[model samples]
Target: MKDFDLVIRNGTIVTSSDIFSGDIGIKRGEIKELGRNLSERAEDVYDAKGKYIFPGGIDAHTHLDMPFGGTFSSDDFNTGTKAAAIGGTTTIVDFAVQPQGKTLNETIEMWREKADGNACIDYGLHLAITQMNDKTREEIPQVIRDGYSSFKVFMIYEGMMVDDLTFMEVLDIASENNGLISVHAENPFVIDYFTKKLLESGKTAPKYHEISRPAYCEGEATNRAISLAKMTNAPLYVVHCSCEESASEIKKAREEGFPIMGETCPQYLLLSRDNYEEEGFNGAKYVMSPPLRDKKNWNYLWKALNDGVLQTVATDHCPFFMKQKRMGLDDFTKIPNGAPGIELRMALMYSYGVDKGNISIEKFVQLTSTNVAKIFGLYPKKGSIVVGGDADLMIFDPEKKVKISKDILHENVDYTPYEELELKGYPVATFSRGELIAEDGEYIGSENRGEFIKRSGPKII
Candidate 1:
């Protein structure tokens, strides 16, 4: 008889704090032991001699089977989770949005239906409060009790942007319930103004997407949103912050002790507005909201990542194929606003941020996994690789390389924005609850193996 269900041997274990050579023993899906050596026998054993064992990534922001602008994103729960697994992520918390005049519960039920038997990894949901009423406000506590510790509100979008009063109420309700709020910060009026001007001049190309949504629009809205959080005395998380202007304000707000947090995506850090200038319709692939900022803003974002202004990194993993993005071939406004990135976040960040000496190993773990767990109530359980923790881990090859290519990637999309961008690090093996889901860039996972998680109330680390 085996002492444990599985054993990871001779691996360098890296956690939020320290790194050391050791072995991990797993039993029934949770970590049973961790130390230099163990004489236990197991039915399955992995010799991780040259790899670094870390907690499997938690991609807290993802949109699988999301519908937008008359078309649905390409990846459904099935393909997105598989891509996440191969990219070293073990779990994802996708957004659930209520349609106009609908209840939060109904939307969650819809998303749950999509994820129930299709996802190959654990998942959670964050309510996107698009409209509010007495009933919506009343539903807050139940949502919190149901393990959804976070909520999202949009600052810009026709038929979706909540009023200041609604935004403030969301802040008050979430804070009162120990829940956090994430805002998509962009000035809708500013975007409307520029969009009209650009089109008025016949500037309908994809490049105009960035031209209309400038950094100032995001910065102004960020400042405004933080001020509202202060008024309500609520904790705020600004999602997809893409410019130096926004980071600077967030830094100042944090210095003033306003309980504000900032999040940015790999696209903002790795790509820039220059991508929008790609010839013909090629630039449409990079057309995400808070569209990629200028190269000059890169310094500030990188500094913020290391300087404490930004608290987390997420993919906002929403994708649309070239054909979908081409919906706006004659009108930029019709372009679907996202690109394929669920599979490249880890490797791209490691190759760009770590190998370039921009952030320490511990910081990388925290940004990609730890901080997300702590913020969304999955810490210690999903973020750490320790005894008594879930056996969700990734064995990474620090020297392995992969050039971003759609043909070889698994985002269910036809193109990758970072095509030909080579990364020196990659996941060799990914395990969720001691079950091997991916190995050496190939998915060996079982369908419907995922379960919905119960998250704790909001609290920051």
Candidate 2:
């Protein structure tokens, strides 16, 4: 019999703290050992001669089968998780929305039903709060104790935005329970007024999407959310931060030693407002909230990530087909809000953020995998390649070049904004829990291997 289940030999192991040449041995589903050279028999062996072995990525922000303006996003848990695995991400923490008038518990149960048996990798959820009441607040502590420790409250979105009192109530509940609260920080009132005015003036093109949700709206809400977090002494994470204005707000809050974290999506780093001007209604494909801003904002976002003001890079991977994007052809308000990106997040971030020298390789590990696990309460076990941890690994080739095309992507969405964009790096192999699920752009794993992961409490780093 083999001494181990699997062994990856002669590889450059990269972790958040160190990079060394070693062989990693796996037994069952956990990493069994790592050393310079070990004479151990194994059922299987991969000679990763010159490749880099890193922990499989963790995408902390994604919207699989999310309901949005008039329709639902295209990818369900099965398709979304498959794409994530092919992209070298072994885990994802998607959102569970508390629909209006419903209790948080009800929403969580509903979300669990949607994700059960459809995932190919491990998954967790962050509760998105749209309703805050005595019952909801009372349930918060119990939910935290039950392994759902993070909740997201929005400052924008009509009918979804919470009032100041409710926001404060949520903050208090989270603070008391040691739960992290994430915010979609944009002033909905401002956006509503601006969007109404823009519609009145006959500005309904995709470009108007950006015009309606200005950067100032994001900055204003970011600043307010930071203030609320400071007052309640709760940790806050701003999701999908887009502009320099909002980045500055996070930087200021962090400078004061506040427990504030921020994350920016891949669209904000690679796409720009110009993408909204694509000929015809094609631009509607990029119409996510906190719309992609001017190219100059990229520098500020990178700086935030490098300086640690922004701690994670996630794909708000809400995908919709091109035909669905046309739902708002005459009126931009009716268009669904999201874009497909989970499969491209790590590659694009690595190519643009690390390969370009904006951040070091270690930082890439932190932003893409480590910090996400740390924030969502699944660290050391899922995010790193340490002994006794889940054997999730990826073999990456930094020099390989490939061009992104929507036709070849696995997202159920019919189009990709990054189509034809040249990228210099790609993952050659991906493993989740000691099983090889992807190799050289081909999927090779059993379906429904994923399990629903519950947040057990605040991450024990």
Candidate 3:
């Protein structure tokens, strides 16, 4: 009789701290054993010679079926999570927004209804706090107790931006309740001034999007957010950090021993502001928040990842179709601000970040998988390959190459921002809780197989 449900043999298993060649034994949806040449019989076995086995990546930032700019994001949970698995990510922590006048529980229940029967892999939620009243403030501790331990606050968006007092109140409440606050750090007023000046000058083009939101806008807001966290003695996480100016502020705060963490997306590291000049509206595909900076900022962010200045790399996977982008044909501000990247983060990081000698294989796992889990309270359970942990993993072929194109991708969008970008390493198979979900660039899993993860409070790593 087979003693295990599955056995992955002859694979080089990797983690954030070490790399070794071994076989893994899994049963009942959890890792059962780890050893060399495991002699136990199994119902099924996969030979992974010459391939690398990595713990399934955990993307900490994603907006699935989200409403923005008069329409919802193109990829809903079903398509979004499938694309994430095909890209080697087995779990995702998506944002759940609280509409005005809605309570915290209502917000979570609404998002749950959207993802309950559609998500393909395990998922969690981080509440985006839009309204902070005496009632909402009272709900923070209970919400944290209910397994959602992180909340988001925007500094720039019109309906989402919180004033300084509200932001401070959030920091204070989260600190006392042991939850973490992630911020979208960009100064709205500064952006408004620049945008007004550019529009009056008749510079209405996609390129003007980058011009209206400069690096300083992000830098100033980053510093201000950090200062507020310091005053409240709260831990803060700055999301989608784009340029050296913002990274510099984060590094300085960390040096001063403040509880601060920073994350940068793959778009910021691989693309540049010049994308805004992509021969007219073609640039609209690259229009995202904290707009891509000068090419010079790339190396600094890369170096920050290797030097421990930045802790995680996430996709900020929010995609919109070209039809939605064309809404701003005459006015740059009307363009929906997001691009598809959930399916490209892993390969892009491996090709440019690791293959180019910018980071080691271990550090790659740390930035893309391990640190994210640790920061967001899913470590060991979702981020590590260990006995008793969930059997979420990926088989990566290091030598296989693929040229990215929208036709070959699975995202429910009409175009891919990473069109024609070749990548050297890619995931060939992905497993979630002992079930094969994706293999060879195709999704083969059953619908509604993913479960909602109950996460604990954040762990300081």
Candidate 4:
């Protein structure tokens, strides 16, 4: 019998906390060894002579075919996970939203069916709690025990927003179950007031979307979420935080020993308000909630990432075509509140982050994979390349260069927020559980092969 099924040799292995050159041996879809080459028979061997081997990315946030704003997101699990594989992301934790009056379990099952036979890689789910009724509260602990340990609550949306009282209740209940609560932190009233004012003044341009949801809208809500966490002793995640005000609030909370964390995205790190002012309808393509802020905010966010103030980076990967985005040509609110980037995240973070010296290679792995796994309860099983760990790995060509354009990506969306952005460094090959799925931006994997990751309760690092 062969000692190992496959061996990836001679690459710089970068993990969350260490970087070294070695070889990784795989067998039975798990990493079986990590050391200098040994004389062992194998079914296959890959020579990664001048590359880097890291844990495949884990995009903890993405929306695949999620119905919103009168239309479903363009990329379903089929296309989204394919895109993720091609981009070297081996796992995704998409959020499953609950419709009002629906049971929490029902929402999870509905999303499970959607992704069951479609996902090309492994996946987990974060239950988006839209209702806070007695039954929903009563079911929280059981749901956590059932492996859906992380849940999201929005602070700003019609028919979705949970009031402060409800937010507190969620925090308290989630705490009791050791569940983590991620908040979409934004003050709805402030946004509504400004949105109405902008409409009245005929300032209905896409730029008004940013103006209406200013940094303070997120900052105020971030602080409020932190307060609830403190009072309930619950871990809080401020999702899609885009500005200095919100980052500052989260930073203060963490410094004060509160279990508060912040998550930002490539859009906030790279793009800014200027995109909303792009000529004509181009602006609508970047119209995600808590819209991009001034470029200055990007500076603060990068600093936060490097300084450990922010713990995770994810793409709220929802896509809408230009035709779909055009639905709001006369009114910004009608446009779907998202942009596509599921397949572009790892490349951008590696090229733009590690190559530019904005962050170290090990830190990049943490921001993209390991930290996410630890927080959401998939640590050694999903994030690291170690003995007895799943063989979710990526072989990256450090010298390879890639240019971002929707034409080259696998996402079903028509346009990309990072279109025309060129970057150095790309993943040449990706493996999910020892299975070679994608290489050189093309997928060779079968759909519906992904299994749902039933996670444990919060393990906040």
lDDT of 2 by residue, 1-461 (tens): 77788899998999987899999989998999998565467788888888889899999899998888768889999999988888899999999988888898898888888898888999998988888778897899988888788999988787678987788889888878889989999888888898999999999998898998889999999999989989998888899999899989989988888888889988998889999888999889989998999999988888889888898999999999888888999999888899999888878888887788888999999999988888888887888989999999989888989899987678888888899999888888999999999888777899889977767555522
Give the alpha carbon lDDT tens digit for every residue of 327-396 in model 3. 9898889988888889888888898888888899999999889899999999888898999999999899
lDDT: the better of candidates 2 and 3: 3
Segments in model 4 whose C-alpha atoms lie over 4 Å from true places: none
Give the Cα-based TM-score of candidate 4 against the true structure.
0.98
Q: What tens digits encode model 4's per-residue C-alpha lDDT throughout 1-461?
A: 88888888888999998989988889999999899874265678888889999999999999998988889999999989999999989999999999888999999889999999889999999998887888998899999988999999999878788998888988899888899999999999999899999999898778888999989988998888898889888889888889998999989988898888878999999998999889997899989998999999978898999888999899999999889999999998888899998888898998889999899998999999999999899988999888999999988988897777778888897788898999898989999999889988899976679999899976776
TM-scores of all models?
Answer: 0.99, 0.98, 0.99, 0.98
Question: Cα RMSD to native, each candidate?
Answer: 1.0, 1.3, 0.9, 1.0
- Which regions of candidate 1 fall more than 4 Å away from where they truly are? none
Going through the candidates in order, what is the number of backbone clashes in each? 0, 1, 0, 1
lDDT for 210 (candidate 1)? 92
What do the candidate models score in CA lDDT, each in turn? 0.89, 0.88, 0.91, 0.90
On residues 220-261, what C-alpha lDDT tens digit does candidate 1 reach at each position? 999999999999999999898898989888899889988898
| Candidate 3 weakest lDDT stretch, 10 residues | 36-45
Off by over 4 Å in 2: 459-461
Model 2's alpha-carbon lDDT is 0.88
> In model 1, where is the ten-residue run with the lowest total lDDT?
35-44
